[model samples]
Target: MSSSLASLALVQQKTGAAQLDRFGDPTIVGVALAYFAVIVGVSVWAARRTRTASDFFVAGHGIGLVALTVASVSTSVSGFAFIGGPGLLYSVGLGALFLILPAAVTNVLGAWVLAKRMRLLGEVRGLMTVPDAIGARYRSPMAQGLSGIAILVGIVGYMATNCLAMGYVLDAIFGVGVTWGIWIGMGVTLAYSVAGGILAGIYNDVFQGTLMAVASSAVFVYVLKLGGGMAGLSNAITPTDAGFLGPFGKMTPLAALSLFFVFGMGSLGQPQAVHKYYMLRDPKQLKWYPMLKTVGQLVVLLLYFGVGVGVKALVSAQRMAPLAKPDAATPSFLLQFTPALLAGIVFAGVAAATMGATNSFINIGAAVVTHDLPTALGRPLRNELRWGRISTLVLALLAGLIAQYSGALVAFLGVFGWGLFASTTVPALAIGLNWAGATRAGAIASIVTGLATTLTLETLAYLKLYAFPAGVSGTAVGLVLSLLVFFAGSWLTRARAAAAIDGDVRLVMDV
Candidate 1:
């Protein structure tokens, strides 16, 4: 009898531990349901306000500064910062920090170089998309059409990354398989994006951003407590993984710097953030945008660094088993270690990040299909507001398919998307708006070069057909080539370039 009792007790203890390790706790499910409810409600509210193409695409240029800042950060960070970022850190140690630490300088650069100019151009021309701004700046429909094509390609990849992360979150919270999770997640995002457009996306971003900030701060504190703080975390990881806490972590110096440089300069061209300039209610509020965006991003990034390092410390300390996959790092840690309620909040935050980004991308891509492409072809859509929502549906489904089949880590896909945007847009749109010397020929040349080079290189790498040097990235090379072609093309055609600048565009640049 005594032996039997002991056996029963041991079995019960083991079962309890197994249950804890599994996802889909009742508390977590409950919180996630509530979060979804809030999202749906916000979407419905915004739908009522979305009356025209302007409202759908640019929120009628009435978004307050605070909302714009929060929404931009929410879109920019997305699942990359919350989910892929932690996973990258877990895989590469401190090198992953390179991906995020550039937010400070990048935010400032975006404001000084692009924010005011984009806003003024939007006002001057009633522009609605990044391609529109490019067309307006260069006075060339072909430039707009090519850039629109580039944006469409990048949108699919970037939206897939976010949708993939959402699938992971849904799988953890609902015990649905990733395939089903992805479809469900995409459905929810589509509901809001199709109905409310960017107006819904903006407010949704504010809500999601607030939740993510609170949850990340709380999780960081919990991580410190579990790992016995930074010094203890370092000691725990260093013995098993030598130099895991170095400045460059597991990556070479050149590789780490490449991440910093690419992400820093690349950020200037990210349509998710750059597009928001058109929605800001007051251009003067641009003075505060850099500071506000940087602070918000830093607070949220605590989770990015904390989860990766904290999980590593625990595994090294023999307190937890090693993770089966790096991308599982965030979800695994939350399920087993954090309180159920906190875990639920973080999961919801992950979904929020993904959904917020998807909404913005959907809106942008739809505008490209419905507005920019047609306008470039000299046949603007008569009912852009209606066709915009339909385009959103088609784009969302296509992106969902890519999210399922891409078979790449979330972080890598995110980087690929960022690179595509930077390569295609930076020289043409960002620089062209600032430099009257930039010609239509230069803008068209840069877009074509960037689009072709990035696609070929990234595709080959994905298929294992080619590889770059140990510390080099295809994106860095593509961006460099694009920049060179932009300047060289302009210089070679300086007379035409000078003649191409419109009086209104030149005035906007001066402002």
Candidate 2:
């Protein structure tokens, strides 16, 4: 039995080692190119239909439910599910559950708090972007502009993280320099985004999301086989290091739970995820959105669950050496153990998903810059569709530049981006829109507080200048403070009769 295990482990190690020599693998490159062509084709199809400002921004408010469900899953998951999530689990053990266990709950929560109301509001108000919703809710252009600015700041950081993650996969597949990969990845994403705007992004996401689902499920099955059974997998690890099986791994309980709170509550603020509301053709269809969306997300996320545990099990079985770092977990395992074709498929799927997700950010950031911010300052553009395209190109380039030059620092951007979005937007948009007591002053203050807390704490955490208590993260702390400030300001400054929320909005909230 021992000899058989040793032989199996040796075979796994040898296969894993082959990843380094796969640069010229035609099968991998061919699969990648095919996926790229599909994305471009989808974008072009969507771009043709995007003739007006309305069409460019929200797919003419006529997207199918299946597309919306998949796009939401795609935008919500991003490179984090494919690369970072698994890597964190492999390196940090159970602490990574803090990052993911909230996923299903949050999906349900977002759907409950946002889905129906957001769609109804968009139809009633002609809302296009998230800032539009916040602005409409508060009747303050300044509040809208500030929300736009906050979103753009976080979008830049979010784009930087995606570009960096994409670059790693591109480099591993093609033997190109990381810098080259970053430019190529950004350029491809910007091409479709600038040409088709949100219309392009949504369609691309539908395509990318489907591929990600299929690829991830396949890789997960392979992970199970490689790690033996779940029992075998567990036995391989628990005997040597029992901590790996702990509820919070090595992290403090507070930190683990903080992950839950931040992800669950903060998800309300993510524009890309919620912005899908603007494109839906039927508000009534959203009743079932949570179920379908969760299924898709869970499918893609299986890779995260499988690879994280599989790699740990392999290491414990003495079949594999420890990783150099956490982020390398996905790329390392894929290249080393999976068939070359499967590795390439996943590589392309992640790159596609990364670029597809980035396009949504670029689309919204452009909308804010060309429409929301300028309109708030009393200079709305007439040629909005044109400006949306131009702004997307410029913003994508800027994010790509930041991603390339910031090097390893881009990792910090992921944490900061997620935290900033949730902290800033949830109060003003999520709670404020639902609660009539929410005032302009309260909205602006919440946005500012969220912006300041997340930026200051995350930067300090990165610099090791301010270490959050073990279980409490910058995101959790920032969100709690922002909520407190928002509620306090709302209590102090009553809403005026002149600027009261729309009667219809109030009725919707009641139901």
Candidate 3:
């Protein structure tokens, strides 16, 4: 009987592999290839104009509102929306809606409050990266060095997350190894990113964003239909599986809190999202950014929640039991149900999403390494454009290497990346923008405290020391500690450092 069971397991694996190969439609591959080719072509065209460091890093601050909007949306969605979003909805019900709210708030606040300031500063100070802003504001090498290192670390993980998602999708659809997926995804991204720099990233994002939006809408509609329409699908699924219907559905108190903290507070520190402000043509464009960002966020929420809940209803737990990996759910759904053409389009969109995100990180990370770090270290690195392109390739390769080994879900990888950024930068960024008393010492303390607490909590959770409640998350703790350290440390040290810190904060706030 044991031998028979073992044999049955082997047969199931072989059968699944065979079905995947048989279903590997070449037309879909062709569409994907064409989409990638167009992106590469655009990058090659843009490369000629990328002659300076500023042009390479920030597109010479000339990106119009439309391109900026598309790039912003593309970077914001990334692999998380395509793969992790559906996966969360598939497993958790409606709890995923919570993710949308925080991001929306971030965009709105960013446009109204942060966007103008970032643009003004980028223009006035010739700032090219986040650490550049931080370093200039504080006039401290330690602060800049720490912030740059933190950005590099966080972005590498974030980029790896995209590669991980791409790898999972390819593995599911093509019966290929995860390593193959990483290499292919990385190679395609590097081809454009290394050649065209920020210009390539922006144009590809515009193209990819349009594709993603259309494909997402179609997928949402189809999934809704497959689940017997929205109302019927909701009714068919068990109450335990209806978390996708409401903000607070079925989530534990802790789990709900984690969602709010991770998604909401964490948004303030996302470099890819924040950097969009620096790329806008003018501060006046901020008026339209909120609307564009909101629409994108809403579309993302609907697409992920709809498909997730629908897939849950369409497939029984027993059937889905084999596809336990969340990252595999999106591809599995397309392969199992959708027509070949639609599936191929959706697949291309997924690939585009990952590329958009990976390229965004590459752009940001390159800026940090090539522009920000050199400025912070007081080292004059000439030929900024050359270094920026080189940095992009280096960071992409590092992320790909990391992605090859990371066995994290797309959402987990994204959240972890967000959390790292939040813990390190949120306190400084928020206070730097608002508070007049925020000092360099306070900012440094906050960074240290936030990083230490977050890393410790994350380590504990990984080791299963004490199960952190889902909603009351580790990042929440880190954020709270960061704020506390910033404020308390400021109060404690304000007497000696008051003049230097107060002057900078007042200058920023008074503007």
Candidate 4:
């Protein structure tokens, strides 16, 4: 039995060695670490000016256009873009291209419609947080409390998902244990986030976003070259493996449409993402904002699809078989093909992407707890700045713990958090801002219905029971239902409270 065990070990070592040869070198770990240090140093420096709750939560409402643009893209596109995106293309083929359409639409719509109005209102009303905006809109503590809780829940899960991706990258690149990777990643994010808050997050995001853009562009060029040029790479794939050219590839039409709705409309509702709009120094600076944002997004998405397609074409299926997990693709690709220095840059980019998103969520979640909850509970809550920092540390720890236990799938883990936020908050917030007839009762009913319906649908889907149709996401359903209840409830309650309504709400209808 001992001899048999020895033989098995020998065989495994040989196979592992062979896999490493085909995949690439493993010493890029040092390069990756150095890049991370530089980013953290920048974040620390940026934190020096964060003196108040407003500064910590929204950079004192003074974010310039360039900083806001970079931070927006970085925070919105997480490790999922760096890692899981390529893996999806590797497995599903061309159909994944459809995912880009919704992003394009959201960017244009946000720039033209949402960004200017939100910034105007945020400045006018002194709205520092999403719940603050909601509470002020309808004069309802219940709306504020519920929205804060929803933000916390969604952000915690989102933060955990990014941490999980960071851990996977460390383990793949450095042969580190998953536990050590998670702890180190968690520690770094908590240190910077707790120290500087939104200032730190936005600063690091600018640096990290630049790194991700450069690295992804370089990787795309190099991988295509290595794959024997575009034509050569195209010729290398089997008919089925050429899914990048197809309409839906492995995803059904419904599933493809679902991705669009989830990623697109979902952006309008994300607390961290939308919060950036509120922080801009001047709404006038937003004239070029959409163009800048779209260019960055296009570059990132193109590189993601390029890398995934290139890897599927160049790398042998047998070698990539073990890396069927989406989160494994980026590291596996680097370790197998790229040189040590460039590979290190890619790894650092991955970590930056993860940390950027995590910091954004941590700061946003802290804001929810410190600003929204205390006000909702009607507590005096003095020393608001101190509590905000404390809340950041606590929330980061909770999210890190969740990361430790989460499985390795990026999209699956992240979609729940994204879906929850979208269903519960997006409709109410969006409609409240646009419609004057929106009442407290309607907003409350909408929030409750959105939350309850999303949760129930998610639970049922998990149980393999009847689920919402494919193309129509839970978020879509929640948004539609929430809108219905919001309007209907407002209509039913309008006559009784018509005279008593506040000036801001009544201003539009009276006009």
Alpha-carbon error at 20 in model 1, in Å? 6.4
Instruction: Write candidate 3's Cα lDDT for 175-291 as tens digits.
Output: 577799888889888888888877888988888888888888888889877777777777767643544456666666667667677677777788887777778887787798888
Ranking by lDDT: 1, 2, 3, 4
| Residues 385-447, model 4: lDDT tens digits | 888878888887787788786553665557777877877777667666666667788878888
In candidate 2, which residue ranges exceed 4 Å CA deviation? 1-17, 409-411, 495-499
Backbone-clash count (model 2): 3
Provide the overall lDDT of each model, using Cα atoms, as 2-decimal numbers.
0.90, 0.84, 0.76, 0.75
TM-score of each: 0.96, 0.94, 0.92, 0.89
Task: Evaluate model 2: give its TM-score.
Answer: 0.94
Across 1-511, the per-residue lDDT of candidate 2 in tens digits comes to 6996767667657755576677758888899999889888988887788789888888889998999999888887787677777877886677887777777888888888887788888888888989988888877899999999999999988988888878877887887867888889998998888778888888888888998999999999998888877888899999878898799887788988887788888888999888888888988887788899888988999988888999889877767667766766777788778888998899998998889889889888988998899979999998998988889888988888888886443335676788889899999998986788888888899999999998898878777798777848898898999999998988888847225777776766666
Which predicted model would earn the best lDDT? 1
RMSD of each: 3.8, 3.1, 3.4, 4.3
Alpha-carbon shift of residue 141 in model 3 (angstroms): 2.2
lDDT by residue for model 1 (181-230), tens = 88999999999999999999999999999999999999999999988889
Score candidate 1 by lDDT. Answer: 0.90
